[model samples]
Target: PFVPLRRITPTELATHGARKNASKIYWTVLEGRVYDITPYLPYHPGGEKELLRVAGKDGTKLFNLTHSWVNWDNMLRGCEVGILVSGNEMPG
Candidate 1:
């Protein structure tokens, strides 16, 4: 599947994480890179509950706090769907 990457903002990211959303997609940010970690959910060693903490938002701080040992760049791999950018970064 060749999904196009996007420039995601905090608000848009928040929208995707809501349970009410029909998309059922989950995204998380690490080091400014946005990942559709939905595919990795079942594989997470910490279980879905812990990983959900980072859903739909920048998880850099919390991820580093717990999984500082993990190399997110390598872990996220193909899941990366975009880059996290402020709303102002979008071209008008």
Candidate 2:
């Protein structure tokens, strides 16, 4: 099965599952890769609140800040949705 890869822009990424977003589908970016972490909320050791802090935005810095020792790439492989790209990064 081939999963569709998303080229997400910063602006568009900001609305995924933030505080007021109705979708509540918590998407986050880590080292340029986008992940749908909503499904992993219950498994998070820090709890859902900590993940919510990074939801709907680039969480690379925050993720590294607290858990740089953690190998996120492997841990998040299953949750990967796509890559974070600039608005002009993709060509028509």
Among all candidates shown, the one with the greatest lDDT: 2
Q: Lowest summed-lDDT stretch of 10 residues in model 1?
A: 83-92
Residue by residue across 1-92, what tens digits does model 1's lDDT show?
A: 99666788888888767376678889988889999888888999999888888888889999989979998798778888888888777553
| Each model's total of backbone clashes | 0, 0
Give lDDT for model 1. 0.84
Name the TM-score of candidate 1. 0.85
Candidate 1: deviation at residue 83, Å?
0.7
Candidate 2 lDDT tens digits, 68-88: 999989988998888888877
Q: Where does candidate 2 stray beyond 4 Å?
A: 1-4, 89-92
